[model samples]
Structure formats: structure tokens, C-alpha cells
Target: MKDEAFDPVRKLVAPGTTVIWRNTGSADHVVDSVQFHDTADQWQFRTQTLRSGDSVVYAFDQEGIYEYYCGLQGEEMCGVILVGDVSLSNSLPCE
Candidate 1:
């Protein structure tokens, strides 16, 4: 995480991959998934307050798009993780 933004705003990973996010900026950050659409699973992931130098990790077990933003920041500071071969059609519009 960086000031008012998420570095590598988009990431592509295989299902079963473990992703890590490290806070390399000065501000505190909280990474959390957004429920962009209705799903039976209603899956969500979040990190504890991430101070500078802190890091968080998540495992991607399903094949789909995961959109997230900084709770301390806002949607403007957002990112997406594309698992498997998911289409951008299911993703939020790019800024």
C-alpha cells in the first residue's frame, strides 16, 4: 500500500495462490474486499490495521475477480485480483 493508492492496482494470480500485500507507505491502511455483486458465497477478506511496514496475506482458492479498497482510504484507492481466467466483465469499471 502507498499513499492514497494501492500499488499494482491489478494483479493476476492462479487459483490456490497466496497473495501478499505489504505496507510500504507512511499511512495506516486496511485492505478489505467489496461486495460488488451478489454471490451465494458472499465472500469477503480484510486485514487488520496495517501500519507502515506491516503486511497482510490472503489465499485465492476460487476462480473469480476480487475487488478491494483501503478502508482507511476509500474506493479511489482500490485494486483487483484476477484469479484463474475470469473475465473483466465481472470486474468493476476502471478509474
Candidate 2:
């Protein structure tokens, strides 16, 4: 259950779209807000420890860039989500 690399780092969705974070990795991960540094407003969402098969979903209602990390260094698991009319992404597969 490990495909942490060689995939889309993050996804941008439109407002009202639900973004799901599915952890298929063998290792446990904390899907928190890139360390929550000062940018409290930016850290609008987070997830509990997600192990293999575990998942989290977030519905975007605002337009902005949301950054996230896997709470692990070296691995440098970082991603960015741009919400808005950014080409009307449908990859989220959620309403």
C-alpha cells in the first residue's frame, strides 16, 4: 500500500468540490497543514492520521491556494490545491 511518489502532488478543485485524501501508503501519515506556521487562515483543513485505506475529504467553499504536507521531512511530501475557475478541474470526483 505505497504509492507516495510518482503521482500528482496535489489537485486543484472548484468551489463546492470535495477533495479526498486517500492514504494508500504502508506508512502512517499526518495530513496536516504544512506545519501550521503563522498562516492560521491558510491552515483551514487537516486530517487525522491516515493509514492504509484511510481517507479524508474537504469541500472547498472559498477561492484560494491551499498547501499541505504529509508531516514528514526528507520525504518532502508537499502539495498545493488551487480552488476556483482554474480550468474547472474534475479530478476530485466529488461534488
Off by over 4 Å in 1: 37-41, 89-94
- RMSD score of candidate 2 (Å): 7.1
TM-score, every prediction: 0.86, 0.69
What digit string (tens of lDDT, one per residue) describes model 2 on residues 9-69? 5576787788887777677776665432232136555667778788888887887666666
Candidate 1 — which pairs collide?
none
Rate residue 11 of model 1 by lDDT: 88
How accurate locally, in lDDT, is each candidate? 0.80, 0.58
Residue 8 deviation, candidate 1, in Å? 0.8
Clashes of each: 0, 0
Top-lDDT structure, candidate number: 1
TM-score, model 1 to reference = 0.86
